[model samples]
Target: MEFGNDCKLIVGVDYGTTSTGVSYALTGSSQCNEVISIQKWPPNCPGLKVPSLVACAGSPGRSLWGFEVRPGMKSFAWTKLLLDPTFNCDSFKVEIREVAGALGILKLPEDRDAEEVVTEFLRHVHQHVCGELKRFLFDTMSPGRVPIEFWMTFPATWSEAVQSKLKRAASEAGFGDKVFTVSEPEAAALAVFRISKDFELNVGDGVLICDCGGGTVDVTSCFITDMNERGVPYFEQLTEETGSNCGGINVDCNLYRLLVTKLGEDFKNLSTTMVGPGSNFMKEFEYIKRDFNGELPYTLTLLGPVPREITLSPGDLRGIFDPVLDRILSLILSQIKRLMQSLERVLSTSKIIFVDGFAGSPYLQIQLKSALRQQMAEVGVLVAPTPERMVACGATVKGLQGIVAQHTNAVDIMA
Candidate 1:
């Protein structure tokens, strides 16, 4: 309804390891309403879950990132895989180097590898947001001065060093010096709480927020106490937990490995087999991996020394993912255990958990919910009302607060 300037615009970028999301909102006197939200996976996507990939194909030094890279998988782009610190797969390493060279950022150190890729992606997003803002506002007003600010979120478990690196990279990515960082779960919680004001959670009320994102599980417990003069609510942290390495990607990897192992038996005699003989193996693998409903089929044909049909029954495929799903469930339970342990030391009360993230994985969600019910018998855990939109919306609200208050103090930061 209302925006900051009706002209001045702010951007929120959730630059995730496995995927990236961008949300734009206007801040003004009435209310800041979200304009658009984009969540992309590796390579570029037109809709939700664009691939976080980068590659190069044309010249030896040419490069590609986001949706531009997916078509040429064998090219120099190694977007999602390169983000992992321990990604030592030889082929992946070679591809990453090629990608880096193509992007003109190969001068970076070996250990500081993925950071550069991420930086470029952030820069790309920055350009996109700026262009969008210009297109939307340039014609309407005689562009005098537009104060542009960017808000990027990271996992709470990110070390101070990582957070610092992200901030510096965001600045380098063309956001200038106006880029700010917030913990992902906190931002989401702020969004959910602001809209659900009638819930009226108290300071003593123990609430757990679980963010089930693509690359991480961010969980935090907080107590909401009051609202600032700007009308944004305040919260105090109680217990925080994260599984930085676990997410939908791991599950995808598991499914890929399973299809390879199960279907490997059919190709044992074949030579020069690439994840099976199909050019579409990688594409199909990506699809099957993220099919949250678990109603998809995995089928492939191999040809070489022996030509045969390889297919997995839904039940057989489910068997492959069972262990991976169980591990995630265990982690969620472990977080609950930690939350209870912390709460016991402080006070005695009923616990309520808020689960969020891109946890549309039917298999994963069922496993997590069952585990949550069993582990915290006395506590209540409900998925946040708008799990997918929580973080982006919350960041917008917090950004508006900062604008209206005209104060950058910590006390006023999320208040």
Candidate 2:
């Protein structure tokens, strides 16, 4: 379970579109066996994440990151979408621009085609990560004693060019030759497999991952190929994998439009136009999003522009979520069915695990459980622990292999 980890560290960064999250573990410490997501950051919060936001406070070199930017300070979000060379600026124009306009940022036209913004945001991430790591090491171990390496996560559906740009961004952020990349879906799968204390997986048992994130829903299935000497599940890919842009963010957008239409432009001007993905109304709406059972209707109260509230019945929530949820469920269920058919065990039970923030929605989890049970009793579904931090946690766990390799190579050279 140990990497040749003396005087070394392993770090993983989940540079998500909505939030950036990180975790660091000493190569030799028991932490190597338990991936710990960094819980502290500037102006400290109790959460394991910070908004993936950046703002131009001055020229190219000066910027504000995360919660550093004050309200109306022209910060940019969804910056990670820039890495997707094929991502349509036009397709996302309204939502992006609304926030940009709200913040008074004017570079949307100029920065749309470049990687500088993404790099700058990641630079902040890297700097903060180093600071946190240094503080921890300074207290328990000597500073400058342990060499650090990074594992960054990206969308499984991202193009190679997009991934290359991400790597370049990491390097520009000062990671140098110490960066590695793992697909978000794979990282999520790894995190779930590594953390599940109960061993329900026997050799040949299949696990399907529905990494339902902010802007994309990726589905990948891997079968248990073998177990490590420690009896950990070893995976082999069983499907081509697929995804779509219909994630939580899309539902957020749909809800946003509905609000604007119902509440009017004045309310829009005063309230968060983005909804729950870091929106002003998130405090009130996020609860509804999580708690609204398909059985009963719900109400959301917003005291903005004027004190006001609105009701969205169970039917209403379904109307907003069904379109997006249907797309995700189809992708996940199809993959499971395909796997079942391929394995020629159509009637036999299989494991399907859901991870990432969207999977935490009780309403969504219920729908998944019911759908799978009804569609086929052979499929068992469970949401992994720390669903919100799946990518970062998984990357942290998987990065140990690289640390061990580097340490061994250094040993070889000395020998």
All candidates: TM-score: 0.72, 0.85
lDDT of 2 by residue, 1-415 (tens): 3234364667888888777789767767655455678887666766777877777655656888786755445666676775675665535545545544433322442544347788788888877777777666655543334667688898877888888889898888777654788888888888877865553777877778888887778888887878887778888877777777767766666666666667677656762333333445554666677677687877776655466668877777887787777788888777767767776543344787887777778888888788878887767788887788888888887787654434211111111
Residue range 1-415, candidate 1, lDDT tens digits? 2223444456667666555666766555232465456544333346543345445334322445566653325432224334444444443344334223322222323434566656666666666566556555544444445556677787766666777778787777677765677788787777656654445455556666667776566766666667666454577776665654455544544544554466554433332223411224445654555463556666755434555566767776677567656766666666657766876456432444443445655556555666667865765545565455566655655565565323221111111
Q: Tell me, by lDDT, which candidate is best.
A: 2
RMSD in Å for all candidates: 7.3, 4.6
In terms of TM-score, the best-performing candidate is 2
Looking at candidate 1, the ten consecutive residues that score lowest on lDDT are 406-415
lDDT of 2: 0.70
